[model samples]
Target: MRTIAVTRYVTPLREGGSLPAIAEGDDGFLYVLKFRGAGQGTKALIAELIGGMIAKLLGLKVPELVYATIDEAFGRTEPDEEIQDLLKASVGLNIGVHYLSGSITYDPNVIQPDPQTASRIVWMDAFLTNVDRTCRNTNMLMWYKELWVIDHGACLYFHHSWDDWEAQSLKPFAAIKDHVLLPFAKELNAADQWAREKIDKSVLDAIVELIPDDWLSAESKLSFDEQRTVYKTFLWNRFTHSSIFLNQAIDARKALI
Candidate 1:
């Protein structure tokens, strides 16, 4: 385990409804330090680190992330002191999320990716355990003419446990429903097929093993491992028995991108 000490706590820049950004690490890295806020919790922090890391491993574009522990002293106020005290009182916060530079924000409708491209992102999200992309918010970034997804701190299908399965709610996340209807479905299917064949039990296990233990402490790490197991199991099941959706996503991605 590599332990990087906290060097300095920088002022936070608010983005959307997400956590505040704090500190520029000695290593020239920027991190969003999750303070004890109105709604922040351990689950969100864990999900962000684990989900982002998993997406990177799945060969998708994601921001670099590192876990950090902030102490009370680092949470003191600045000269401006306009910021809320609790917002700065995070010790042992998630730090070192790469602050993207020269990135432009665009509404989901503005970037208008083709159906194929959109399908690929959907497939990627489904396979990598992302559960945050929804109708109201498709959090993404456009830089250098490329669309990059962010704020996956709500992934891992934690809500799947709820059995409500309302029609409207299901429609949004049913990767099956969205991707299969895409015109680019066929191509996305082919790509997913190829990737699926390459993925085996050992490979999945190896990927899970690479997760940093520091990010999830001993007890929490165990729970995190269980989540990975469920993720892999669901992935295999979907690829084997429900491949139609996967195919559609692949084709859709090709058309959009």
Candidate 2:
């Protein structure tokens, strides 16, 4: 992933608890900065990185992700106390998504995608165990006639508690019922075949490598190597047993219709 320095903080996108900001990067591109110091902390950034990459691998459209650096003194002139504190805490490294200018939030009622596309989106979310992407807050955007996914910080909920990650990997995702695209995801079986053909364990290994040790070492009780191993193991277990969640999604869609 490319690294860029944030040149200026444009504005706060006060949507959820995490105060993501629209900022200018040194490369003259605008990015939506997901601060390391946000309430969810760097774990969210890890999810964003890994989940976004997996979506891309499955032929889904996700904005480009980069490592965004912030100079320690950059936030010194900020006037807002809350934002100032956030900036101060996030001085080191953060995750940034290429901002899609003029894009609008996806309105499910207004735009309907084909059955295959919708099924693929639903399958991806279920496989990741993402809790967001509900109808009320579809973390999707419409950019230039294409659907773009964003804000995957809420995926991989098993990481929040490593108590039984192996077993959690095989668990069915009940939340698929609430997915914004579920109603249109009529081809989930085909989506499962897509996963079988397009993704593999090696792809996950590369995505896990993208996570910075600094983020893993910040608050995790596990060693850096242990953390990496856990992520790889958990994801692989889930990938091998995608049928569990795929069935869960089918049942949920049946209930929906």
Candidate 3:
């Protein structure tokens, strides 16, 4: 992930509970900044990092992620108390997704992706246990006539309760029925095979390494190595048990059909 200094807080993107903001980086690029101090906290950022990297590896379109440095003083000029408070709390490192200019939110009713792409997305959500990509809020964008994924902060939900991560990781993702693309995903089996081949141990390692140490420390009491190991174990277990999710997805697709 690239690191950039947030030069300006442009505006608040009030779509979800976290209240991510659009900011201008020192590099003159716009980024949708996910604050470290949001209600969901650092774990949300961790999910975003891992999920976004995996999506990229699967040949899905996702915005570039950056380490956005926020100074406490950046919010001094902002008149809104909520924005001011958010910036003050997020004084250090935060996650930023490169903003897509002139892009429109994906509307399934108007635009439909090919079965191959749709299957890939469905398989990805099932694999990651992402519960956010529903019909009401697809978390997808239409840019340059292509589908791009965004806002993966809600994935890898097993991490939210570390008490039984191993067991939780093995559970089937039945929520896939609500996935916006389920109706169009006719090639899930093929997508499953392709994803399994790409997301090996090395790929998981690379993605985990992208997570900043501060974020990990802020969220868990575990040591850095311990946290990394936990994440690796959870992902490996989920990948090994992917059949549970795939079967659920197949069933969901049939219901939609």
Candidate 4:
């Protein structure tokens, strides 16, 4: 439960576009952190922490994460800095998906993700409400010839507030009809089994246990735990009931074959 302190706020990196960025520290690590949007709410904050952890648990090579606290002295002084310093005290973490190296942005065509690989990301996003990707620009990370997706602070269905998330609402994502879908629809369709296998109760319990008490109010902790229990149950018992989801994943991979 060691909350990383904001050592020195460095210049913002612009590649993240809408997301805020800066340098920060923990007991012994230096990271370029990404903050959730201003007044966004705890759901998004927890998503970055919990979602990153879950992705790691699922054996995805997501970036390392440690909960961070932002203080007033490090607050922003300009429009560009506003998002980074949104809360007088806020939580954030660094993403290892990409860096501010001399070169940025890669051609998706050159580093094509197979339907299975692409579907896995889409499946992760659907469960998380990570709307950063779409038909137009995937905006995923490409480093050392690998695809790494970052910037999930806006996930976990933040748009739904703290209410119990509906899985059917997540079904639309299973359909195949567009540029992004065309590439990975079958794989997305076939992912119901994977989702069922991956989103297990034991894993969900581990995630809740990892949340530091300081990051949550007593009431919030109660609600979050309740909701997580519900979510885990639904994913395990009912997620694969949708034929479209399983079919989209099948179609996604079929395109590649």
Candidate 5:
């Protein structure tokens, strides 16, 4: 991932709990930055990094993700104490998604993606065990007449508590039925086949490796390498047993249709 120095504190995007912000990067681009110092801390950033990468790897449309550097001087002028503390605590590496200028939230009633696209999104969410992306909060955007996914901090939930991660990997995501795109996801089988072909041990390695050590240290008591292993193992297990979730999605879609 490319690292950019955050030069300006544009504004705080207080939509969600993490308190993401619109910041200007040294590259002359505006980015929606996910701070590492927020309540969820670096774990959320890890999920955002891995989830966004996997989506891009699956040929999904996602804004460019970068490692945003929060230098000591940044955010010093923010008048809000909460925002200032968040900036002070996050004076290091954070995650940023290139802001899609003029992008609007996706409205299911206004437009529905094709079956194949919908099915792929459903399958990907199931694979990640993402619990966000619902009617109330679609977490999707329409930019330049194309669909773009964002805010994946809710994915990889198993990492938050690994006590049953092994078993958790095999369980189909029950929440998938509530997915915003499930109604049009008629191509689950096709998505299953595609994912099985695209994601492998190497692909998982690449994505997991992108996670900075700072993010891994806060998780559990395990060493960074150990945590990475657990993550890779869990993801591989889920990928191999994806049928469990694919079937769950198909059943849910069946009920919906």
Candidate 6:
């Protein structure tokens, strides 16, 4: 959506594998910057954009996604060699999530969500095929007493191998069993019905259109339109075939109980 220039490199948030940074934007707001030049590359950024947008559409709490511009000159002043290398590689447009200050990491044991909210979240993760939201690493935040989903770079794993995307899209998401909220997700069937109604072809198209062309063309052999089509097909197939994963989630909830 909005493009912002990274004015300052505040610090590296070393919690995850990506090493996303907390930086000040030209808009005078703090943002968690996901570098385009990182080891995971632009695909990870694409996952974040698509997953975050879908979550927002499903009425889940997610920070605003922004295009963050970074100047190569800014890397010269960084003291850490690791961060310096990362900045040097990410000299152009990057993905930034508006930072939520005073937000605490979500702990399922301490703060439990209602079954409806939890099931919606579980359904969202299953539909996206996100594998990172386990009890060990929730990748979620509790801000202002609301549960916010974050760090979706690990979703959409099929993108790494587009040849089998069609089959992968239909495969059940077994990883959903380990989802932190699975035990509390009592409304999986209802959540699936609601999502099927909301996330149609038009919604998938709008979300995939948000990804920049530069990211798609950087290292891929596919054309821009081809890339967009691939994403749309994968997501639409996943949404339509969600009953497979919905049943898995319900079974997991039963075992937990």
Give per-model CA RMSD. 5.7, 0.9, 1.2, 4.7, 1.0, 1.1
Candidate 2 residue spans exceeding 4 A from truth: none
lDDT of 5 by residue, 1-257 (tens): 89999999998887878899999999999999999999988889999998999899888999999999999988788899999999999999999999999999999999999888888889999999999999999999999999999999999988777788899999989999899999989889999888877888999987998989988865368888889998899899999888899999999988988
Question: Which is superior by lDDT, 1 or 3?
Answer: 3
Give one digit per residue, the lDDT tens place, for model 1 in 1-257: 13344566676666544456666665666655544332444445555655566556545566677656655566465454535454354455454566678877535545566544554566666554454565555656677877666676656454334243222222323453333224333445544555565556676556556444444444543376665565455545544543545544444445555
- Provide the overall lDDT of each model, using Cα atoms, as 2-decimal numbers: 0.53, 0.92, 0.90, 0.53, 0.92, 0.90
Q: Model 6, which residues run further than 4 Å from truth?
A: none
- For model 6, how does the per-residue alpha-carbon lDDT over 42-143 read when each residue is reduced to its tens digit? 889999999989988998899999999999698798889999999999999899999999999999999999988899999999888999999999999999
Model 5 Cα displacement at 126 (Å)?
Answer: 0.4
Q: lDDT (0-100) at residue 216 of candidate 3? A: 83
Scored against the true structure, residue 239 in model 4 reaches a CA lDDT of 40
Lowest-lDDT window of 10 residues in candidate 1?
Answer: 164-173
- Deviating ranges (above 4 Å) for candidate 1: 1-18, 33-40, 78-89, 93-95, 114-117, 159-186, 210-257
In model 6, the clashing pairs are none
* lDDT ranking of the models: 2, 5, 3, 6, 4, 1
- Backbone clash pairs for candidate 2 read none
TM-score, each model?
A: 0.66, 0.98, 0.97, 0.69, 0.98, 0.97
For residues 129-158, could you state the per-residue lDDT of candidate 3 as single tens digits? 999999899999999999999999999987
TM-score of candidate 5 on Cα atoms, chains taken together: 0.98
lDDT value, residue 19 of candidate 5: 94
Worst 10 residues of 3 by lDDT: 211-220
Weakest lDDT window of 10 consecutive positions for candidate 4 = 94-103
